[model samples]
Target chain A: MNNKITQNLYLLPYALWIVLFVIAPLLLVLYYSFFDIEGHFSLMNYMNFFTPVYMKMAFSSFWYAFLITFISLIFAYPTAYLLTKTRHKQLWLLLIIVPSWINLLLKAYAFLGIFGTKGIANSFLEAIGVGSKQILFTDFSFIFVSVYIFIPFMILPIFNSLNEMNPSLLDAANDLGASKWTTFRRVIFPLTINGVKSGCQVVFIPALSLFMLTRLIAGNRVITLGTAIEQHFLVTRDWGMGSTIAVFLIIIMFLIMSVTGNRKRGV
Target chain B: MSKLVRFFFAIILVSAVLFYTVHELNNSEGYSGRNTLTIYNWGDYIDPQLIKRFEKETGVKVIYETFDSNEAMLTKIEQGGTTYDIAIPSEYMIDKMRKERLLIPLDHSKLPNLHYIDKRFMDLPFDEDNKYSVPYFWGTVGIVYNSKMLGGKKITSWNDLWDSDLRNKILLIDGAREVMGMGLNSLGYSLNDTNHNHLHQAKRKLDLLTPNIKAIVGDESRLLLENEEASIGLVWSGVASEIMSENKNLEYAVPKEGSNLWFDNMVIPKTAKNIKAAHKFINFMLDPKIAAKNAEYVNYSTPNKHALSYMPKGTVNDERFYPSPELTRKLEVYENLGKKNLAYYNELFLEFKMHRK
Candidate 1:
């Protein structure tokens, strides 16, 4: 009984933090979602969420998020795989992560300069005879910058999973007369599926809610669920609608986590 | 099933406690000492030296903060979390604050330099009789174009933006009121037009201009124009003035179809803890020499009539930066469209943006 009481006391600060910061804010958001702009309690905001305009925005936002995650995974998987083979693997992995330690806004601003009309990218294109093209404020720049920003997050998990894998499995596959590609496809990939899932989870969810990149890089040509929520809360002072959208986002977050989450019994 | 029921009950109890605690926290008044004054204004709107001067003159520590947009400022002020003594919001937002009773009326006796304010800028519709707001800086929304890049294509009117030759050559300022006003002005309607059919028509009109529009950007619109990324831009007169100084080939024009004339005004919010110091700061800013210096620094048209004498000959006389009185008369000030109509405007603008894809 004394030991049980001591354990409960140890959990006090953490429990209080969860209650005050996490649960409280979430509850407040849920509470705010039921009201209209006039402070009147109503279902109007929820009704508004179902409209075609918002629906289309949500669809496009998901489409962009999917594109960003897929591109990041494609680039990250090979990079992570190669990192495991390098002699100084940890040092190279650390180098890959160093860029991410810089502020996201700073990186976005750097891309703005690099992809500008008179920027290095255009200058190179011109020198190579492709000529300069409108690169900044395009869908390509938006996706490229997003993938660049998220690549580290995607690679770290996959790298860890690859590192944790038994080297004996590869040797065993070789002894069984399997080609390198077959070993990777049949053994390595199936084993590292958890890492890919977690990597995708880390990238896809945040990509869905990316607001600043949409503004700075995409030049407001693209709008995401995050942008819409910011617009409603800050721009329009319609917190009710913002909260409603946020509530839906929370639900979608839970759904995504469950789908990609670790199973009870795992390899 | 019993566990699930218990879990839900615990959630309900926790939420009830949270709501009560939050309510209590909001009601608890923050302690505001006499020597401190907080001022919130738009980013890069004021001269930093002036803030230092104000602090030295008053012996009061100024806690300064900045916001990017009027809506953002309003949302922060309305939350009542911070006790901001002074804020500078544009005309329509002043009107909105007036309705919400978020602002406190000024005591004219405290502001002796009010006489230096331009008669033309006084008693404006947004805050008639200057009850709650003092005019800070005013400008018009117009086109900023590089004549060299345009290749002899003079941009005298909004219709020029729609020219097929100008395809993918224009960058629009990213604001619902400004861009939507462009569409409404092109169609010969009031920018504050609340008619659903009219707004939809404006959106459709903007749709045709999409081919010429390269991007809709905020502050970067000026940079894009400076770099000659786009030949023309829909931007504020102040930004146009600043860019024109950098590149001599650039020129600003208030479109022939008319445009938005915005006045940013300084006011004390209802939550002010240092009203006296706020008034002193306002009076100091209104001084002709100070106003003129601020005008030159920020590159916006000053509302202090007497300050013009203190300003440089070329800057004061430039009709593009300071629109002629006759031209200023034709420009319309944005009115507070109330909460519902303003949200609709934002929605319509979003739809227009989504259509760009």
Candidate 2:
């Protein structure tokens, strides 16, 4: 009882801060979502969220985020496997982490310098007597930058899972006359599924909301739910609409988290 | 622990808290009193020397913060946390703020130097009789092109953006209102039209032009000019001026159809704690010499008639800076659309973005 009391006392400040900052603000957003700017309670803002344009923007955001997650996993898995196989793991880890320490905005800007119309890629192509200019501000740049920015998130978790794998299981599969590829597929891949799932979750959530990169690098040619929320709050000054969209986003995130959590519990 | 040491620790803790609280209180009070004023404005939109002169003349310290967009400034004020004594918002946004009752009416008598302003800029639709806003700078949205890259072909209309010859070699402003308004204006409709069918037609035109566009850039027309990324672009006059200054090959021209004329104005918000200081600062900036110095420093056109005389002889005569009366007559100022129309316009903007291949 005394220990519990001490623990509660220790958590008091954190609980108060969270309630004041996070929970209170979210509750205010929820309240605003139900009303218009007139202060009277109304459902116009929520009704507006169901418009076809908002639906399209939300779907596009999800689709792009899904694609970025899947692509990052595909590229990350092999790299993580290689890192585990390397003898000098610390040096390889350093190489990966060092670039991540560079600011995300700087990295996005770096890609701009390399992929712009007169950038290195185009100059190289020009030197080879090929095409003189290149396409840089299309959907392709959006996906490329998102995948590059989020590869580290995918790799770290998969790397941890791979590193934790017991060699004995693979040796056992080999002893049982299974082929190397089959053993790896059956034993190794199944064990790392949790890590892959977690990594994908991390990558998806951020990519869904990380529209600033899209705006700056993709030149605001693409619109996402994140951009819509920003425009509603900042540009339109419609906090009611902005809050409604934010609430909808939170609901979608909650659904994703609960479904994933239930699957993990069942496993 | 010894009683003496415990007492010392308590004193230290109490003093630290007191110091922090005092610092915050001081910051709040300093801006509220006659000692200082706070101004929020658009980035690179004003002359820093003007701020310095205001500070020196009035003995009121100025704390200035810059935002890149009018929407951003409005959102900050709407949150009702920070106390900004003065702000500069575009004409349309000023209308929106006035409807929201977010602005405090100007005391023109307090601003005696208002005589320096051209009468045409005053009593405009956004704030008639200049009740709330003071016009700071005015310019137009138009097409800027490289003569060398265009193969000596004279570009005249918005249709030039859709030309097949410039495929994958054109640029447009990233702003939805600006780009969509251009399409609407080219279609012989008002730039601020919120009609659904008109918007759809504008979207169709933009969709057709998207393939030819290399970038939809904001505040980076110089990058496009230096890199030769696009042969032509829909850009602001301020950006066009900067590009022309750097590269002599560039030329700015208003479209034959028509274009947007915008004016950013200074206003005091109702939430301001230092109204007197804000008014004094506005009057100080209105001084013709100060206005001229500001206009020369920041490359934007000033509304002060007296300031125009003080500008460099070439700048005063420059056609781009001061368009001919005929050209000026063709321009239209953007007006605030009603709520329903704003929704429709935003919806159409979304459709254009999503339906693009």
| TM-score of each candidate structure, all chains considered together | 0.92, 0.87
RMSD of each: 7.8, 5.1
- Off by more than 4 A, model 2: A1-4, A7-27, A36-52, A128-130, A167-178, A262-267, B1-34, B49-59, B109-112
Winning model by DockQ: 1
lDDT string, candidate 2, B1-357, tens digits: 699999999999999999988678656644334577889987786778777767667767788898878778887898899989999999998999999999999998899999999887889989988899999998999988998988877778888777788877777775778888988988999898877788889989888887777766666646766567677888888878877787887888888899999999999997798899999988988999889988887787888999999989888788887786678888888888865566566656656666654
- For residues A21-75, could you state the per-residue lDDT of candidate 2 as single tens digits? 9899989989988877555689988887788878878888899999999999999
DockQ, every prediction: 0.51, 0.46
lDDT, candidate 2, at B39: 93
Interface RMSD of each: 1.1, 2.4
Q: Over the true interface residues, superposed, what is the Cα RMSD of model 1? A: 1.1
Model 1 Cα lDDT, one tens digit per residue, B190-232: 8889999999999999989888888888787888898887789
TM-score of chain A for each candidate? 0.97, 0.92
